[model samples]
Target: MRRESRVERSTSDMAGGNRFYFPTKAPESPAFYTGRAAFMDTVDTLERAISHARRILSARQLLPVPDFARETFPATKPQWKGMGNMFNVVGTRMRPKNYKKITSLLNQLAECYNVAHVGDAPSVARATKNVLDMFGRVDAPIEDLEGQKKPVTIDDAGRAYARGRRKEASARVWVIPTKTTDNPSVVMDPEFFHEKILKSYRKITELPTTSVLINNVPLAQYFVNPADRERVLRPLKLTGLLGAFNVFALSRGGGTTGQSGAVAHGLAQALAAHVPEADLILRRALLIRRDPRVVERKKAGRAKARKKYTWVKR
Candidate 1:
């Protein structure tokens, strides 16, 4: 929450006088604007983000229906705080000020969720949690102060899936840092994050980063050596390695590569579940959307598209 007055360089480094810090975590995409809107209308409705996650996962059962129906969406103190800040940043970019749009988007997401999961309760549960985790505190389309609309068309499910894919790819990529024993700069090969204290959600997606964040370690670190992290934290996270059956892998999809990448993304995502600090590890992996199309060669092909036999210019 700390804001640096000027995230800038020295005068010599300033060309047109522009500098900024990229927030470690960005907001969810606007594809789910409806849910974002509804979530914003109220503070305690903060739970709406959670509820919306369920709704998108399973509208009929996963989602909790309020005891009473309301004529209009509810608004609360936090909602006002967020909305006010929203406009301050982009100024009129999040226009139309219509929360209904957000609700509609949520509905669409729910519909898509129903279709995708169909009957897997566990996956439905996972998706619900994933949705909430990704957007619960993230601001809405504040950038849309101008009240723009990204209509949900027939292809929106596909598009939304792609957006999700991009986030998984480029978001918080983690690289493992091997300890002195393993080679400090080297990505640790023996370390494992998901070997125990886990279930279906536990999947070894990629090699973890060397550096890690332990929520309970900060206060104690001021008095102890930083190297203590290995003796303390690593032992706790990698306890699963004691067992025999385990394998590590990398995967991505939905942006163009398809469902394989999606699984890798999901596997990393599962590791991050319930453990925010673990996210920093996966963040080191730079996964993201690749170019949609291949580049064309400059040379003229005498035969097929790019292949040409050894031919004479006669």
Candidate 2:
């Protein structure tokens, strides 16, 4: 045959060698992707990872079983609620835009895993490391939910005690079911009663009337502002156990607002202790967590915190 050009010879040889012929190129580096493309790719990868994690956690019994069977009262037949609110207690209901959904999912899984494997230190540690690795991937700071909080306990005297803080204020609170024999006559600040609150107490026939005593003073006298009184009573009001329990609080540090908030926090915890079911409600209301905010310290040049000294033209 007449001398074929080098390219023509190679092409014919490649074509004749196989039914299909294609050029192979090196894989594109991640850095070559545009910002949007990179972001989209990362999101997709993370979404897949989240699904994988859910499956792994479910297999490990660290997530709630989706199809739990509940027995009907009269029929006593096991009924599947059909995926039945798997995230009723934990996990986010938000759409997966960025990291929020995945963050909550991983965090809750980690918590459940930690709680479930408390005795198995080696496995718990490994699981924690894996969870932290996932959190790092998402640039999230994982909460230390490993330790199971001690279950709220009741004293032999039927009282639940809890401590709470807000700003610089701290409070020690005790809650007890109102009883027929528990007398309020010995209170040091008996003159500081609120008539409206007392009226509400009287209206509660199903449960004994509730009373609030702060430092041996009636709540009304302890908090002169009606708003402060309301803040202190909010937890009880939300639980609809306003007149069902007695609250005794000893508050120290900070101002009236802080003290009221502290007492409210303590009251919420105490209520949660007394009524375990109310814990979820209080948690939803964010009453169980301590307030981390405080009065910002005054800087050297500032008049008060961020308030700058009056600027004047030279």
Candidate 3:
């Protein structure tokens, strides 16, 4: 009893070569055999694929590689973000099915990684094939499509014009670059300024100011509702072209809401025309399309479009 080393104690417990011994202190747990094995396998497969793709994509000097390290599962956001940027650069022309499959696979991989790390193997195995497939094709080249549309061009007036309609409202919008102005300075109406800026200054004396006019009135003054104002400015804001152009819109055949919507649609079209490159952004935002919804006519016997009066037995 003077001293007994761990090795000696372990050897004493396993007296025979045929029998195995587990120390009392080292309690047996299913996690040792079940969770870690599959988790490490899945992670290893994914990590290898990711590394291989990264090496292949390293040739793209402009694309920065995502930071990936072993056991960094908890911090996978940057990896996904980096992957997204890379995908944008090379996945635009990828077959829709492939694109969707790859996206789903990445999502599954993230989910499976989390679940597997927590000792759930069955759940993680569900999407293993999909995740592997995604990792395999992460570096594939995008295919080119035929007959690409030509970019829109600005007119002689240096303005792009578009028409938009919403409900009974219709609008004609024109967008012109602020840089084309011959005047050295532009005098803006007090109401045109944002509330935050308006509170600090009586008047703004600035060059190359963006102006939005609706029916010869400033945007803020015309669209009193904040929602309406936001709707009118959404296209520009989305394109990061806000305050870079002058917008003139003539809206008719609708109230505030309709008119605002019409102007927004028109503005979006005009912006697309001015900056042909931004057409994709405008299209995705659904700002280029004319809203087809209109008010349904009231039925003669109904309270409103589809409502009927409650029956009262006499």
Candidate 4:
């Protein structure tokens, strides 16, 4: 046989030998040529796969016809719809015509029972009339229930009463008006025969002096502090009624300061009661307001309120 040509020999050898031999006559590098061919083949395969998938998707768009087996046996009606009006359909359905008649009968029965057991129409009319008559009998205004339409007035004793409190101290105070004559009358008489002439009759009016007593003791004696004494007397001074009335206060509880405040509050109230016009003045001066300040409670693990115990690591 003639010597085999290189191309044919290589082709036959490749067909008979291992299928993975690299070709020598490739123009570009073998690795690049093989990779390029593999990439092109892969691109073709992907395009074919995409086209096939598109065809399947287009076919799926058409609706499926019902099978003969399914058409032979149709679905049954829903149980709820079949049950119909036998079951009451509350809010969903229109009320039956008998509902109105039933409600009317119930209302009539209730009215009849009320008339038979409670009373007849004429008796009801009489009861209503009685109520109207009773309402008509009330002639006085309802506000009169608060007894004593007028402002608080001093009794025949000429004393005004009031109560005051400050902290733990409380005082019951009474202010009494004092009577004083403004002028004095004197008359001299001459005796004719009798040895001694009768002493000339003289009537004198004295100026009233105001005094403040606390628990039956003088204010000065009860309250040692000058400030406390001044606080107790502040209300009278503010109202310009210092010498007008004598104050007797029974104060209990709390210290001297609190007692003084309590007494002042009581005196203010009494002054207001004594002279209604002074109410505005006393209120403006804040004498009528009760002091709300109190001592803070001591917290646990502390020496006193807000005072922490000293820590010493020994």
Q: Residue 11 in model 2: shift from native, Å?
A: 92
Instruction: Determine which window of 10 residues in candidate 2 has minimal summed lDDT.
Output: 72-81
Q: What is the lDDT of residue 1 in candidate 4?
A: 71
Q: Report lDDT (CA) for all predictions.
A: 0.35, 0.64, 0.63, 0.58
lDDT of 2 at 304: 89
lDDT of 1 by residue, 144-224 (tens): 333332322213221111122332332122222232223221112343233321543544543332233222223143215
Candidate 4 stretches with Cα past 4 Å from truth are 1-152, 181-207, 311-314
Per-prediction TM-score to the true structure, in the order listed: 0.21, 0.46, 0.43, 0.44
What is the model-wide C-alpha lDDT for candidate 1? 0.35
**Which ten contiguous residues of candidate 3 have the minimum total lDDT?**
183-192
Over 132-235, each residue of candidate 2 has an lDDT whose tens digit, in order, gives 45333322223422322555678999999989899989999999887742432212122323443466565434434678999999998889999999999999
In candidate 3 the C-alpha lDDT for residue 192 amounts to 35
Best by TM-score: 2
- Pairs of residues clashing in candidate 4: none
| Selected candidate, larger TM-score, 3 vs 4 | 4
Q: Where does model 1 exceed 4 Å of error?
A: 1-257, 288-309
Error of 4 at 228 (Å): 1.3
Error of 1 at 114 (Å): 40
Candidate 2 runs further than 4 Å off: 1-149, 180-207
Candidate number with the higher lDDT (1 or 4):
4
